[model samples]
Target: MQCSQDIAAPSEVGAYLLEHLPQATLITLDTTGHCPHLSAPLETLAAMETFLAKE
Candidate 1:
């Protein structure tokens, strides 16, 4: 998971991971900052739940 406007890691990092890792799941929260879980708790949790449900 990552914040769309994260400066520390950036959304490109997530995209790269998703492209490289076959099983990688990229969840981009439409928010700012590095910590998506803290900055976008509900969105993060929802994404997590949706991802976990697929598994």
Candidate 2:
């Protein structure tokens, strides 16, 4: 799965992942830069737990 910051991209990156990596998951958070784990730890952990629980 891919975790992307809402502010970091050409947008097509997420689209490409979804298209080319159909088995993968993509998560976008309303944050800046590339350190969502530090900036949004709770949200990031929650997302990770949710994704992992699915498996």
Candidate 3:
């Protein structure tokens, strides 16, 4: 979910998350909003699959 986009400058939100939530693995998708699976299904699925495959 793109729940965090509500914060200022959604495009740069990843930076904030990375700095504050250091343990979290944040991935930013361009031109997407809350419920990216619906807004950007292909990109979202690809990113999820790639993350899952990582060792």
TM-score per prediction, in order, is: 0.87, 0.72, 0.61
Off by over 4 Å in 3: 1-9
Q: List the candidate numbers ranked by TM-score, top first.
A: 1, 2, 3
Top lDDT model: 1
Instruction: Pull out the clashing pairs in model 1.
Output: none
Cα lDDT tens digits for candidate 1, 1-55: 8888999997778889999999887877899998878888899999999998999
Candidate 2: lDDT of 46? 87
- State the lDDT of candidate 3 residue by residue for 1-55, as single tens digits: 2434534346456666677885767777664466778778888898899888984
Please estimate how well model 2 matches the true structure, expressed as its whole-model Cα lDDT: 0.70
How far residue 47's Cα lies from its native spot in candidate 3, in Å, is: 0.3
Clashes of each: 0, 0, 0
What's the lDDT for all of these models? 0.87, 0.70, 0.66
Ranking by lDDT: 1, 2, 3
The parts of candidate 2 lying over 4 Å away from their true place are 1-8
| CA RMSD of each candidate after superposition | 1.0, 2.5, 3.6
Q: Which stretches of candidate 1 lie over 4 Å from their true place?
A: none
User: Which has the greatest TM-score?
Assistant: 1
Candidate 2 per-residue lDDT, tens place, 1-55, comes to: 2345445564578778778985977877665556678888888888889989999
